[model samples]
Every structure is written in C-alpha cells, then in structure tokens.
Target: MIKAIQNIFSIPELRRRVLFTLCMLAVYRVGCHVPTPGVDAQVLAKFFEGTEGTLLGLVSAFTGGALERMTVFALGIMPYISASIILQLLAVVFEPVERLKNEGEQGRKVLTRWTRYGTIFLSIIQGTGIAIGLQTMRGPAGEFVVPDQGMGFILLTVITLTAGTAFIMWLGEQITERGIGNGISLIIFAGIVANMPAAIVNSVRLLRTGALTPLVGIAVLVLMIAVIMAIVFMERGQRRLPIHYAKRVVGMRNYGGQTSHLPLKVNMSGVIPPIFASSIIMFPATVANLVDVTWVQTLASMMTPDHWLYNVFFVALIIFFCYFYTAVTFNPVDVAENVKKQGGYIPGIRPGKPTADYIDIVLGRLTFAGAIYISAVCVLPTILIGEFGLPFYFGGTSLLIVVGVGMDTASQIEAHLISRSYEGFMKGVTLKGRHG
Candidate 1:
C-alpha cells in the first residue's frame, strides 16, 4: 500500500495531477467555512442542530456542514447536481437534447453548456428558497438565524450562493480537464471524507462518556470497514458477454474474425441512481419544511427518516432511478447494431433484433439484481442510523460512494502502474472482476 502511494507520485504527470486535485479540494474545503452575509453563524449552527432528522440534515451532510454554517458555499455543488439530473431526465423526452447526447464530442459540449445554464437557474431557485427559509428559521435557543430578514438579505444570499455554485461547477470541470480521477465524484467524495475525523471523535467521545460501549464502537468500526469492502467488490463487478466476429475478406489482407467480450457493469449506472433518488425524494420534504403548509408538513412527517413508508418509497424510487438511469445510459439497440455491423454475434443468437433482445434480457436480469443490492446496502444504513442512532457517516449511500470511488481511483492508478511494468497491489491475488 505504501509503495502504491509512492508509485503514484513517481510519475511526473501523475504527481502534478494529484497535486492539482488536492489543491482544488483544499480550496473547496476552505470555501465551505466562509460565511455568507447577514447570517448569524452561531445561530445557524444551533438551528441545524435542532433540525437533525430533517431533510436539511441530509443536505448538510452532502455539503460537509456548509449549509449549517451558512457559508458562501452553503449551497455547495448540490444545485449543479440537481440541474444535471434534471437535464439527464429531460434528455429522455427532449429530442434536441437526445440528439446532442448521441452527436459525439460537439453534442456533449452543447449539452454540457445547457446543463451549466440549468445549474444557474436551479441555484437561483434553491438559494432563494433557502434564504427565505433562513429568515424565518430560529435556533434551538430561540435566536434568529438571519438578522436582516428582508428582501436585501434574500437577494444577497441568492447572489452569493448562486455564484458560489457556478464557481464550484467551474472548479470541477477544471479538475476533470487537468487533474486525476473524476472531478465531480472527487468533490463529493472529499466532502464525505472530510467529516470522517469529526465523526470518529464524536463516536469516541460517546464511548468515553458511557453513551456508547467500547465493544459496540469497535463493532461499528469493523462493520464500516466490512461494508466498504463489500461496496468495493460490488462496484467493480461486471457481466461479460462473449461475441464472435465472422471472418470477412478484404481487398488484399484478411482483417475480420476475432472473439471479444462486451462488459456490462453489475451496477451499470454506478452511484448515480441512489444520489438522484435521495435528492428527488428529499426535495419535497425540503420545500414542505420551508413553506410551512399543513399538508406539506404532514407529508414531510410521514417521510421522516425511519418510517416504513419512507423506506418503502425510498427503495422504490431507488429501483426506478436505477432502471431509469441505466436505460438512458445504455442502449441495447445501439450495441446490437454496432456489433452486427462489425459482423459480431453471440454464439447461439441471431444478429440484429434478436441480439438486441437477448442483450436486453440479460441486462434486465442483471439490473434487477443490481437494484436489489443497491437498495439493501443504501436502505440498511439509513434504517440502522435512524433507528439505532448510529453515526450518519456509517450510512449506506455514503459508504457506497466512498468505497466505489476508492476502488475506481485505485483501479485507475493500478492500470497506470501496471502499464509501466510495475506489479500491481493485487498481482498475487486472483483479482477477478466482481460479477463477471
């Protein structure tokens, strides 16, 4: 493990990318503490403390406590994430966006531009709502979170938060272009990881104070590590479909027959479905809390973290989004067409439509299993945390993201080292791909 870390810095380009990523992440963490104007930081923190178990708590976790602090970056990258999800869903219905997605590089650029615009719009909406909510919100001690509860405060907050989100989005793009790993995932991963030390401290304090037993604390730690390893194993899993390309005669040289495999990930959509589902499910509750309407309040209460209704609905939404995202991202028809054009066919399947049907059937089964796995992993943590009052950091979605990203980043680094003739960490291990 130590050697692998050293090897990462041994290559000049990799070292530069790693350093650049770290610098950007440091910048983001720093910004998370820069308070927004007109908010009482102490009062905001108290308000968040009282708001535990609410949708705001979930938002706070994602923002790495920025929302509780009412920082300039309180909005974090969530508005951008919301916009991206919205645009992705729209791409399903909008012919133009769909065309752009299928148009290759230029189309992706256009779609990305549209997503940025949408992010700005979403930031305005979410920021304004949050500011207004803050104006009326009070801490547990009855202190006002926002002193200047007026249009000026709202507008200032709107501008600050929207601009902050836009800046964050730009930073992520820069990381993607000039740094290592995926920019957005790394950003979210950083936020999730940044709070780990505090969580551990709190857990230890609880143990010391007799609020938690040392044995139980140790058990929790062991469970967390086991969960992370499980997530890593699952995320790296895939289903490989064998394909044989028929020999074809060229003008002079023969250049056809070959056997290859199509790799379909066990979790094809990765962590996207859970993230999307959580956001969508929480949005209504967030609005309900902000608006203070009777029906909305009742609805929000019903969806509280540990409720059976909440878990059931949450699981269903997760499954739906898993299939929805998978469908959007992977097209069996396209794969089948490409394969048929290349004279590739599954051993016992006909080319064209039959191949597409067979692929879809296999995909559907794999996706069903994947959805079940994701729901179990994600839902179990939430249930345990809410019911048994465990640390929120040990929850399923967070665990999945941390583990998945770690595996992906490690795999990328392993590939780089192996390409340069170094034995990878798993060189002596079987190192089989997960589901495949």
Candidate 2:
C-alpha cells in the first residue's frame, strides 16, 4: 500500500490529477464555511440541533453541515442530482429523450446540457423555498433563523444559492475532466467524510462523560467495521452468465470462437435506490417544516427516521427504486441484440427474445436480493440510534455513497498505476478490480 502511494506520485500525470482533485475538494469545503447573507448563523445552527430526525438533517449531511450554518453552499449538489435523475426518468418515458439516449456521444452531450439547465431551474425553486422557510424557522429560544424577512432577502438568497450551486457544478465538471475519479460522486463523498472527525470527537466526548458505556462504544465500532465489510463484499458481488461465441471464418483466419462471461452486479442500481427512497420518504417532513400546520407536523413527526412507519415506507421505496432503476438502466433486450450482433449467445438460452427474457428473469431475482441488502444496510443506523441510543452520525445512505465513491476512486488510481507498469495497491492479491 505504501509503495502504491509512492507509485501514484511517481507518475507525474497521476500526481497532477490527484492534486487537482484535492484542490477542487478543498474549494468545496471552503465554500461550506461561507455564510449566506441576512441569516443568523448561530440561530440556524441551533435550529438544526433538533432536526436530526427531520428532512433538514438529511440535507445537512449531504451539504457537510453547510445547511446547518446557512452557508452559501447550503443548497449543495442536490439540485444537480435531482436534475440528472429527472432526465434519466424522462429518457425512459419520453420517446424523444430515449432516442437521444440511444444516439451515443452526441446524444449524451445534449442530455448533459439539458441536465445543467434543469439543475439551475431546480436550484432556483429550491433556493426560493429555503429562503422563505428560513424566515419562518426559529431556534429553541424562539430566535428567527433569518433576521431579515422580506422580498429582498428572498431574492438575494435565491441568487446567492443559485450561483453557489452553479459554481459547484462547474467545479465538479472540471474535476471530472482534468482530475481523477468521478467529480460529482467525489464531491458528495467529500461532504459525508468531512463530518467523520466531528462524529468521532462526539463519540469520544460521550464516552468520557459516561453517556456512552465502554461496552456499547466497542459494539458500535465493531458494528461499523462489520457493516463496511458487508458493504464491500456485497457491492463486489456479481452473477456471471456464461456466453459462447460461434466460430467464424475470416479471409485467412478463424475468429469469434471464444467464451466470456457477462457479469451482472448484485447492486446494479448502486446508491440511487436509497437516495430516492430517502427523498420520497422525507418529502412530507420537508413540507411540514416549510408549512406550519398542527396535523401536518404530527404526520411528519410520525414519519421520523426511527419510526416504524418510516422504516416500512423507506424499505418499500428502496425496493421499488432498485427494480425501477435497474430496469431503466439495463435493458436485457438491448444486451441480447448486441450479443446476437457479435455472434455470441448464452449457453442454454437461444439468442433473441428468449435470451432477453432469461436475462430479465435473472436480473429480477438479483434486484430483489439487492433491495433486501440495501434496506438492511440503510435501516441499521436508525435501529442503532433509536433502540441502542448510539450517537451514530453516519447513516446508511451516507455510508453507501462514501464506500461506493471510495471504491471507484481507488479503482481509477489502481488503473493508472497498472497502466504505467507499477504494482497496484493490492499486490499479489486476487482482489484487484473486484475489491476496488
């Protein structure tokens, strides 16, 4: 591992990319501390203290606590994520969008441009809503979060937040083009990871104060390690379907007589399911926070993260999205057609509709198992917080994002090292691509 670290810097290109990514991340972290104008930072922080089970807390986690401090980056990259997801769903529903999706590189560029436009629109809407909501919000001592409540404040906030989000989007794109790993996912991973030191410090403080017993603290540590191991194991899990290529004669040689396996990942949908689930389940709570109504507040309170209703709904939504996203992203019919075009076929299944049907069946079963795994992981943190009273700040959704993004970044690093004839991080180990 030490050698791999050295090797990364040995390659100048890789070193430059790594440094550029770090600098971009530093910029994001710095933005997280820049306060938005016309807001009482202390009061906003105090307001967020009691929102651990609310939608605000969830958003705060993704923002690296920027929302808690009402920073200029309080909106975070969520607007971009929302826009991308919306475009993906449109691709599945709208014929024109679907055609654009199938048009290859040019199509992707157009879609990406549209996604940026959508991100700006969503940022404007969400920024306005947050500005209005902040004006009505109060801390425990009844102090308003936003000191100035007027159309001017709202307009200023909207413009500031929208501009902040746009800048962040540009930063992410620059990192992707000139740096290492996925820019957007790395930004989110950085946000979640930024809170780790605070969580550790809080845990230690609790342990010192005897609020957290040594035994429970040890258990929490063990559980976290176990959960991380399980995540790595499950994320790398795949079902490989054997494919045989028919022999073909070229002008002077024989070709296409080979066997290869198609690897279908267990968690094909990745972190989208849990994210979508969280957003949908937390929508009512967000609305309740924005609109002050006795019945609505009561309903949202009942849907807290620790509540049984919330868990049930959360699990159901995760399962639904796992299958829905998997279907949208992976079309078995397209795969079958491609395989047929390449003169390849699954050993037992005939090439065409039958193969597509078989692949779909296998995918459905895998999606079910993936959904179950995702639900278990996502709900475990809530269970620990609620039942065991553990001050576990890292939720399951954040864990998934962190681990997934970390693995992807590591893989990219490993690829660079190996391409340059250097040993990878896991030298003499079978787990190369699988572990990354």
Highest TM-score scorer? 2
Residue pairs with colliding backbones in model 2 are none
Tell me how candidate 1 scores on lDDT.
0.82
Candidate 1 per-residue C-alpha lDDT over 138-172 given as tens digits, one digit per residue, 9 for 90 to 100 = 77767788877889998999999999899889889
**Local accuracy of candidate 2 as per-residue lDDT tens digits, 1-436:** 7877898999999999999999999999999999999998888877677777667888899889898888889999999999998898898889999999989999999999999999999999999989988889988888898776899999999999999999999999999999999999999988999889999999999999999999989988888888899999999999999999999998999999999999999999999998888877887887786678999999898889878999999999999999999998899998999999999999989999999999999999999999999999999989888877888766599999998899999999988877767778886843333334
What ranges in model 1 sit over 4 Å off? 283-288, 291-298, 386-392, 427-436
Candidate 1: RMSD over Cα atoms?
Answer: 3.7
| TM-score attained by model 1 | 0.91
Q: What is the clash count of model 1?
A: 0
Candidate 1 clash pair list: none
TM-score of each: 0.91, 0.95
